[model samples]
Target: MRKLLQPILAVALGLALGLAVTWIAGESPWHVLKILEKGAFGSGYDFGMTLFYTTPLIFTGLSVAVAFHAGLFNIGAEGQLTVGALAAAVVGAVWSGLSAPLAPVVAVLAALLAGTIWGAIPGWLRARRGSHEVINTIMLNFIAAGLTSYVALYLLKNPDSQNPETRPIGPGYLIHQFGIFGGAPVSAALPLAILAAALVWVLLWRTSLGFEIRAVGQSEPAARAAGIDAGRIRIIAMCLAGGLAGLVGVGEVLGNAGKFKVGFSPEFGFIGIAVALLGRNQPAGILAAALLFGALHKGTADLDFETEHVTRELSLILQALVILSVSADGLWSWMKERRRPVIPETAGGVTC
Candidate 1:
């Protein structure tokens, strides 16, 4: 219960702080709250848009969470997703003649494979060469961005448009959007994202590999002592994390854009770190955190038009505050634990 209660309280605190900032900025807190609520859920279209924003976050959240379980901080999710999205776009456009069903499947596989390879490079470096994953992942993000830009601008530039984007994929590559969202681009990708979350939960909780990963995360020395190949587990966990992050392309390319755009991502990968942290790196918690972020993103879109003082940038402030709140909570817990008196054990049984 503390696990759940803590995050909820942290969120509330963050929201309260954010709203107070708005009040100080000469906006009524209540008015801002109403606008946020309305913008996020006032209509089916709005809600669908929120889900659309959410789909990729789930993928990235799971990606980070998976790496976290293996004691890895996957800062390279942006690069992984970028490479994966480009790979999917390349396959979808190059194989335009491929029939439906098979087209998306193959493209998605390309995405996963691309991301896995990208993620593996850092994992292998960390495990074999003692290179830090954070620095490697950050470097890879730049490489991925440059590589994708070169490919899109030079190799597969759309002849029809001057934008730095790939050519449109074949119709077969497109996924169907749900009509229930009032024509919002909420697609089959939403269900796929939810399914991915469920599968992640099962993998983390119901499998031996999960235990090994968690064990390695808790203490590499202990895991090695227990005869677990900690290095191998790290590589496998990173590979899985990359594949999950790669699924973001499934929604962006096949579901919405039908092509790859150079700057399509609004830093979903970076925001995912906060999602994983807020969710406590658990799958179910990640889902809830992702949805909250998605709603915040969608809700803030209207602030510029509706409020005199508040702007969409408020969303960034809100996100930062929430992350700070969670971090402070964790720090407080750690301090409390450290200050707690430990009962000593003696050879006989207990020691005073």
Candidate 2:
């Protein structure tokens, strides 16, 4: 019960704060609410957009969750995702003469490899030089951004095109759309994300390898006593986590854009940490939380289009507010107790 109520409470608090801000700025509170509502679920198309956005979040959130389970904080998901997308774009663009059916399969594999390599670098540093992954990943993000930008702008740039995006992948690389459901733009990658989440959950909880991961995370000395390779496990865990981030790349490029753009992700990897936190690091919870955020992202634009006074970025503010409320859970707990009637202590003649 509490688990469910917490999300409700967070959302309520966030809405209240957002309405207050809008009202103070001389905007209609009800109008903003309507905008948000209509934008997120106005039609089947909107819901499809919600799911399209969510697929990547689930993948990236799971990536962070996996790292957290291993007692490592991976702050470089942006970098991993960037490299993965770049790798996929290159493969899809250059690999020719292959059957159209085999294109997506080969492209996704290329992305996974690039992301794993990027993750392995930090893992190696931590395993060998006792460096912290947090710092290493942060630095790597800058490098990845610069390198990706260079490729998108110069090396991969379509000479005839005006944008800083790469050339479009061949027609065979496109994911088919299901137009019967109100023209939803959902791609094939959504199912892959669901499968990835389920497999990751199984790998973490139901497998012998999962035990080793938990053992290494719980205590290095104890893991050693249990004959687990602590250092190797850490590296493997990082690569595994990075692979999930890479999947986000697959969904975005192969499923959505069908080509690599200079800026593909709108910080999906970054927002995933919040999703992981709200989900309490569980895969099932993460799915729901990711969908909530995904809806917010898709719906916020509608809010702006509906209400000229408001901006779409207000959704980010609401998300931040929710995170704040969740962080202050202790206050909510105390208030709940305070509002309840006090019960008399039970002992012999306790009422008297």
Best by TM-score: 1
**What is the TM-score of candidate 1?**
0.93
Off by over 4 Å in 1: 329-331, 334-352
lDDT of 2 by residue, 170-235 (tens): 667666665644766677788888888899889999998887888888888999998888889889
Would you list the clashing residue pairs of candidate 1?
A: none
Candidate 1 contains a number of clashing pairs equal to: 0
- Per-prediction tally of clashes: 0, 0
> Model 2, residue 9: what's the lDDT?
79
